[model samples]
Target: MKTLVVYYSLEGNTKEAAEKIASSIGSDIMELVPVKDIPKKGLMKFIHGGSGATMGKGTELQPYTKDASSYDAIVIGTPVWAGKPCTALNQFLSDLSSTEKVIGAFAFAGGSADKCLSFLREKYPSIKYTVSLADRNSKKLAPENGSKLSAFIEELKSELISN
Candidate 1:
Protein backbone atom coordinates (compact mmCIF):
# COMPACT_ATOMS: atom_id res chain seq x y z
CA MET A 1 0.00 0.00 0.00
CA LYS A 2 1.15 3.55 -0.77
CA THR A 3 0.15 7.06 0.21
CA LEU A 4 0.32 10.39 -1.56
CA VAL A 5 0.19 13.87 -0.07
CA VAL A 6 -1.08 16.23 -2.76
CA TYR A 7 -1.54 19.75 -1.49
CA TYR A 8 -1.40 23.48 -2.26
CA SER A 9 0.34 25.78 0.17
CA LEU A 10 -0.14 29.52 -0.27
CA GLU A 11 1.85 30.65 2.76
CA GLY A 12 3.45 27.27 3.41
CA ASN A 13 1.26 26.71 6.47
CA THR A 14 -0.54 23.80 4.84
CA LYS A 15 2.76 22.42 3.60
CA GLU A 16 4.18 22.45 7.13
CA ALA A 17 1.17 20.54 8.42
CA ALA A 18 1.40 18.17 5.44
CA GLU A 19 5.02 17.41 6.19
CA LYS A 20 4.00 16.56 9.73
CA ILE A 21 1.24 14.29 8.48
CA ALA A 22 3.59 12.60 6.02
CA SER A 23 6.21 12.16 8.73
CA SER A 24 3.80 10.14 10.84
CA ILE A 25 3.24 7.80 7.88
CA GLY A 26 5.69 7.56 5.01
CA SER A 27 4.19 9.14 1.90
CA ASP A 28 5.46 10.89 -1.21
CA ILE A 29 4.38 14.51 -1.64
CA MET A 30 3.17 16.64 -4.55
CA GLU A 31 2.68 20.39 -4.65
CA LEU A 32 0.02 21.81 -6.98
CA VAL A 33 0.88 24.92 -8.96
CA PRO A 34 -1.18 26.98 -11.34
CA VAL A 35 0.45 28.21 -14.51
CA LYS A 36 1.11 31.36 -12.45
CA ASP A 37 1.92 30.76 -8.82
CA ILE A 38 0.36 32.84 -6.07
CA PRO A 39 2.45 35.04 -3.85
CA LYS A 40 3.35 33.72 -0.41
CA LYS A 41 1.26 36.43 1.23
CA GLY A 42 -1.60 34.53 2.84
CA LEU A 43 -3.96 37.49 3.01
CA MET A 44 -3.83 38.33 -0.69
CA LYS A 45 -4.11 34.69 -1.69
CA PHE A 46 -7.11 34.39 0.56
CA ILE A 47 -8.75 37.19 -1.41
CA HIS A 48 -8.00 35.44 -4.69
CA GLY A 49 -9.49 32.17 -3.47
CA GLY A 50 -12.84 33.73 -2.59
CA SER A 51 -13.17 35.50 -5.92
CA GLY A 52 -15.60 32.91 -7.33
CA ALA A 53 -13.37 31.99 -10.19
CA THR A 54 -13.49 28.72 -12.12
CA MET A 55 -9.69 28.63 -12.43
CA GLY A 56 -6.91 31.07 -11.78
CA LYS A 57 -4.08 32.71 -13.69
CA GLY A 58 -2.34 31.05 -16.67
CA THR A 59 -3.43 27.74 -15.06
CA GLU A 60 -0.47 25.88 -16.40
CA LEU A 61 -0.99 22.65 -14.44
CA GLN A 62 2.20 21.14 -13.17
CA PRO A 63 2.54 17.62 -14.47
CA TYR A 64 1.52 15.08 -11.88
CA THR A 65 4.96 14.58 -10.31
CA LYS A 66 3.45 11.32 -9.07
CA ASP A 67 0.42 9.54 -10.44
CA ALA A 68 -2.61 10.19 -8.22
CA SER A 69 -3.98 6.72 -8.98
CA SER A 70 -0.92 4.76 -7.90
CA TYR A 71 -1.48 5.43 -4.23
CA ASP A 72 -3.77 3.31 -2.05
CA ALA A 73 -4.76 6.51 -0.25
CA ILE A 74 -4.33 10.24 -0.92
CA VAL A 75 -4.53 13.18 1.47
CA ILE A 76 -5.49 16.52 -0.11
CA GLY A 77 -4.33 19.52 1.91
CA THR A 78 -4.87 23.27 1.53
CA PRO A 79 -5.50 26.38 3.55
CA VAL A 80 -9.01 27.59 4.17
CA TRP A 81 -9.66 30.84 2.34
CA ALA A 82 -12.93 32.53 3.07
CA GLY A 83 -13.94 29.08 4.24
CA LYS A 84 -13.17 27.11 1.04
CA PRO A 85 -10.45 24.86 -0.26
CA CYS A 86 -8.04 26.83 -2.44
CA THR A 87 -8.91 26.63 -6.16
CA ALA A 88 -5.85 24.49 -6.91
CA LEU A 89 -7.25 21.36 -5.25
CA ASN A 90 -10.63 22.02 -6.81
CA GLN A 91 -8.91 22.15 -10.20
CA PHE A 92 -7.03 18.90 -9.51
CA LEU A 93 -10.17 17.19 -8.26
CA SER A 94 -11.88 17.46 -11.64
CA ASP A 95 -8.97 15.68 -13.32
CA LEU A 96 -9.32 12.46 -11.36
CA SER A 97 -11.68 9.59 -12.26
CA SER A 98 -13.20 7.71 -9.39
CA THR A 99 -11.45 4.43 -8.55
CA GLU A 100 -13.00 3.57 -5.16
CA LYS A 101 -9.89 4.65 -3.27
CA VAL A 102 -9.32 6.29 0.08
CA ILE A 103 -9.47 10.08 -0.31
CA GLY A 104 -9.17 12.48 2.64
CA ALA A 105 -9.55 16.28 2.78
CA PHE A 106 -7.70 18.40 5.37
CA ALA A 107 -7.58 22.19 5.71
CA PHE A 108 -5.34 24.52 7.74
CA ALA A 109 -6.39 27.94 8.79
CA GLY A 110 -6.27 30.33 11.75
CA GLY A 111 -9.79 31.74 11.70
CA SER A 112 -13.31 31.10 10.51
CA ALA A 113 -15.57 28.41 11.81
CA ASP A 114 -15.45 25.36 9.54
CA LYS A 115 -13.10 27.08 7.16
CA CYS A 116 -12.66 25.46 3.75
CA LEU A 117 -14.64 22.44 4.91
CA SER A 118 -17.67 23.24 2.77
CA PHE A 119 -15.62 23.97 -0.33
CA LEU A 120 -13.85 20.63 -0.08
CA ARG A 121 -17.19 18.89 0.30
CA GLU A 122 -18.66 20.68 -2.72
CA LYS A 123 -15.69 19.87 -4.91
CA TYR A 124 -14.98 16.27 -3.89
CA PRO A 125 -18.30 14.83 -2.90
CA SER A 126 -17.00 11.26 -2.82
CA ILE A 127 -14.03 11.73 -0.51
CA LYS A 128 -13.87 10.79 3.17
CA TYR A 129 -13.02 13.95 5.14
CA THR A 130 -10.75 14.86 8.09
CA VAL A 131 -9.41 18.32 8.96
CA SER A 132 -6.59 20.00 10.92
CA LEU A 133 -6.11 23.50 12.30
CA ALA A 134 -2.99 25.69 12.63
CA ASP A 135 -1.94 29.32 12.93
CA ARG A 136 -1.60 30.99 9.56
CA ASN A 137 1.32 33.22 10.51
CA SER A 138 3.47 30.90 12.63
CA LYS A 139 2.81 27.83 10.43
CA LYS A 140 4.03 25.52 13.16
CA LEU A 141 1.90 22.53 14.17
CA ALA A 142 1.90 20.45 17.34
CA PRO A 143 3.27 16.93 16.95
CA GLU A 144 0.27 15.30 18.57
CA ASN A 145 -2.02 16.53 15.78
CA GLY A 146 0.07 14.59 13.32
CA SER A 147 -0.82 11.57 15.41
CA LYS A 148 -4.47 12.45 14.79
CA LEU A 149 -3.73 12.57 11.08
CA SER A 150 -1.78 9.32 11.33
CA ALA A 151 -4.71 7.62 12.99
CA PHE A 152 -6.92 8.75 10.13
CA ILE A 153 -4.48 7.42 7.56
CA GLU A 154 -4.16 4.12 9.42
CA GLU A 155 -7.92 3.68 9.48
CA LEU A 156 -8.05 4.18 5.74
CA LYS A 157 -5.24 1.69 5.20
CA SER A 158 -6.90 -0.92 7.36
CA GLU A 159 -10.16 -0.60 5.48
CA LEU A 160 -8.44 -0.84 2.11
CA ILE A 161 -6.37 -3.81 3.24
CA SER A 162 -9.44 -5.58 4.55
CA ASN A 163 -11.10 -5.41 1.19
Candidate 2:
Protein backbone atom coordinates (compact mmCIF):
# COMPACT_ATOMS: atom_id res chain seq x y z
CA MET A 1 0.00 0.00 0.00
CA LYS A 2 1.06 3.55 -0.63
CA THR A 3 1.24 5.33 2.74
CA LEU A 4 1.74 8.98 3.55
CA VAL A 5 2.99 10.47 6.78
CA VAL A 6 1.68 13.97 7.43
CA TYR A 7 2.75 16.05 10.40
CA TYR A 8 3.23 19.50 11.95
CA SER A 9 6.09 20.43 14.20
CA LEU A 10 7.02 23.60 16.06
CA GLU A 11 10.10 22.36 17.96
CA GLY A 12 11.13 19.61 15.49
CA ASN A 13 10.13 16.69 17.70
CA THR A 14 7.12 15.77 15.62
CA LYS A 15 9.13 16.10 12.43
CA GLU A 16 11.81 13.76 13.73
CA ALA A 17 9.24 11.17 14.69
CA ALA A 18 7.53 11.47 11.33
CA GLU A 19 10.82 10.96 9.51
CA LYS A 20 11.61 7.89 11.54
CA ILE A 21 8.18 6.43 10.88
CA ALA A 22 8.34 7.17 7.19
CA SER A 23 11.78 5.64 6.89
CA SER A 24 10.81 2.55 8.81
CA ILE A 25 7.71 1.97 6.70
CA GLY A 26 9.13 3.25 3.41
CA SER A 27 6.30 5.75 3.07
CA ASP A 28 6.15 9.27 1.70
CA ILE A 29 6.16 12.20 4.15
CA MET A 30 4.72 15.69 4.16
CA GLU A 31 4.95 18.56 6.63
CA LEU A 32 2.11 20.88 7.44
CA VAL A 33 3.22 24.50 7.59
CA PRO A 34 1.02 27.30 8.83
CA VAL A 35 0.92 30.62 7.02
CA LYS A 36 1.08 32.52 10.33
CA ASP A 37 2.85 30.59 13.02
CA ILE A 38 2.87 31.32 16.71
CA PRO A 39 6.02 32.41 18.54
CA LYS A 40 8.52 29.59 18.37
CA LYS A 41 10.25 30.56 21.60
CA GLY A 42 9.31 32.50 24.72
CA LEU A 43 6.35 32.90 27.08
CA MET A 44 4.17 34.00 24.22
CA LYS A 45 4.60 30.59 22.63
CA PHE A 46 2.98 28.91 25.59
CA ILE A 47 0.30 31.56 25.91
CA HIS A 48 -0.62 31.53 22.23
CA GLY A 49 -0.11 27.82 21.50
CA GLY A 50 -1.86 26.65 24.63
CA SER A 51 -4.85 28.92 24.16
CA GLY A 52 -5.13 28.04 20.46
CA ALA A 53 -5.01 24.33 21.21
CA THR A 54 -7.46 24.57 24.10
CA MET A 55 -9.88 26.46 21.88
CA GLY A 56 -9.42 23.95 19.02
CA LYS A 57 -8.39 26.56 16.49
CA GLY A 58 -7.30 25.77 12.93
CA THR A 59 -4.80 28.04 11.28
CA GLU A 60 -4.32 28.80 7.62
CA LEU A 61 -1.82 26.42 6.00
CA GLN A 62 0.67 26.93 3.25
CA PRO A 63 -0.14 25.14 0.01
CA TYR A 64 1.33 21.64 0.08
CA THR A 65 2.54 19.67 -2.94
CA LYS A 66 1.36 16.25 -1.87
CA ASP A 67 -2.07 14.98 -2.80
CA ALA A 68 -3.14 13.37 0.46
CA SER A 69 -6.16 11.68 -1.06
CA SER A 70 -3.98 9.66 -3.37
CA TYR A 71 -2.45 7.66 -0.55
CA ASP A 72 -4.03 4.44 0.60
CA ALA A 73 -3.03 4.95 4.23
CA ILE A 74 -2.37 8.18 6.09
CA VAL A 75 -0.38 8.59 9.27
CA ILE A 76 -0.69 11.93 11.02
CA GLY A 77 1.75 13.18 13.62
CA THR A 78 1.44 16.20 15.88
CA PRO A 79 2.78 17.72 19.05
CA VAL A 80 0.43 17.81 21.96
CA TRP A 81 -0.35 21.32 23.11
CA ALA A 82 -2.72 21.82 26.02
CA GLY A 83 -3.69 18.16 25.61
CA LYS A 84 -4.71 18.73 21.98
CA PRO A 85 -3.14 18.57 18.54
CA CYS A 86 -1.39 21.73 17.32
CA THR A 87 -3.30 24.26 15.22
CA ALA A 88 -1.40 23.43 12.03
CA LEU A 89 -2.40 19.79 12.30
CA ASN A 90 -5.94 20.81 13.17
CA GLN A 91 -6.05 22.80 9.97
CA PHE A 92 -4.70 19.91 7.91
CA LEU A 93 -7.28 17.54 9.33
CA SER A 94 -10.04 20.06 8.76
CA ASP A 95 -9.03 20.62 5.17
CA LEU A 96 -8.60 16.98 4.28
CA SER A 97 -11.14 15.93 1.66
CA SER A 98 -11.01 12.16 1.93
CA THR A 99 -12.03 9.96 4.84
CA GLU A 100 -12.07 6.54 3.28
CA LYS A 101 -8.35 5.83 3.55
CA VAL A 102 -6.89 3.97 6.51
CA ILE A 103 -5.70 6.37 9.19
CA GLY A 104 -3.15 6.21 11.98
CA ALA A 105 -1.86 8.87 14.37
CA PHE A 106 1.10 9.60 16.60
CA ALA A 107 1.63 12.37 19.13
CA PHE A 108 4.58 13.89 20.95
CA ALA A 109 4.05 15.37 24.40
CA GLY A 110 5.99 16.53 27.45
CA GLY A 111 4.02 14.11 29.58
CA SER A 112 0.91 12.02 29.22
CA ALA A 113 -0.63 11.95 25.76
CA ASP A 114 -3.81 10.15 26.74
CA LYS A 115 -6.00 13.19 26.34
CA CYS A 116 -4.45 14.13 23.04
CA LEU A 117 -4.79 10.63 21.62
CA SER A 118 -8.33 10.39 22.92
CA PHE A 119 -9.22 13.67 21.29
CA LEU A 120 -7.95 12.41 17.93
CA ARG A 121 -9.90 9.16 18.18
CA GLU A 122 -13.03 10.97 19.23
CA LYS A 123 -12.82 13.54 16.48
CA TYR A 124 -11.62 11.22 13.73
CA PRO A 125 -13.22 7.85 14.15
CA SER A 126 -11.48 6.50 11.04
CA ILE A 127 -8.12 6.52 12.84
CA LYS A 128 -7.42 2.85 13.47
CA TYR A 129 -4.02 3.00 15.16
CA THR A 130 -2.20 5.40 17.49
CA VAL A 131 0.96 5.83 19.55
CA SER A 132 2.26 8.54 21.84
CA LEU A 133 5.79 9.55 22.77
CA ALA A 134 6.43 11.26 26.10
CA ASP A 135 9.20 13.78 26.69
CA ARG A 136 9.85 13.82 22.97
CA ASN A 137 11.74 17.09 23.04
CA SER A 138 14.27 15.59 25.43
CA LYS A 139 14.58 11.96 24.36
CA LYS A 140 13.47 11.74 20.80
CA LEU A 141 14.19 8.30 19.27
CA ALA A 142 15.67 7.16 22.58
CA PRO A 143 15.96 3.42 23.13
CA GLU A 144 13.02 3.46 25.53
CA ASN A 145 10.47 4.54 22.93
CA GLY A 146 11.90 2.48 20.11
CA SER A 147 9.77 -0.55 20.86
CA LYS A 148 6.55 1.45 20.85
CA LEU A 149 7.39 2.97 17.50
CA SER A 150 8.34 -0.39 16.07
CA ALA A 151 5.05 -1.84 17.22
CA PHE A 152 3.15 0.98 15.59
CA ILE A 153 4.94 0.44 12.31
CA GLU A 154 4.30 -3.26 12.44
CA GLU A 155 0.62 -2.63 13.04
CA LEU A 156 0.47 -0.34 10.06
CA LYS A 157 2.16 -2.90 7.88
CA SER A 158 -0.35 -5.48 8.96
CA GLU A 159 -3.23 -3.13 8.31
CA LEU A 160 -1.95 -2.42 4.83
CA ILE A 161 -1.65 -6.11 4.05
CA SER A 162 -5.18 -6.72 5.22
CA ASN A 163 -6.54 -3.93 3.11
Candidate with best lDDT: 2
**lDDT by residue (tens digit), candidate 1, 4-106:** 8888877777787778767656678888887666666657755566663324222346787888877777778877655566677766766767534536767
Reference-based lDDT, each prediction: 0.66, 0.86
Residue pairs in collision within model 1: 35-60, 83-116
Backbone clashes for every candidate come to 2, 0
Model 1 lDDT, residue 150, Cα: 67
Model 2 alpha-carbon drift over 4 Å, by segment: 137-143
Instruction: Tell me, by TM-score, which candidate is best.
Output: 2
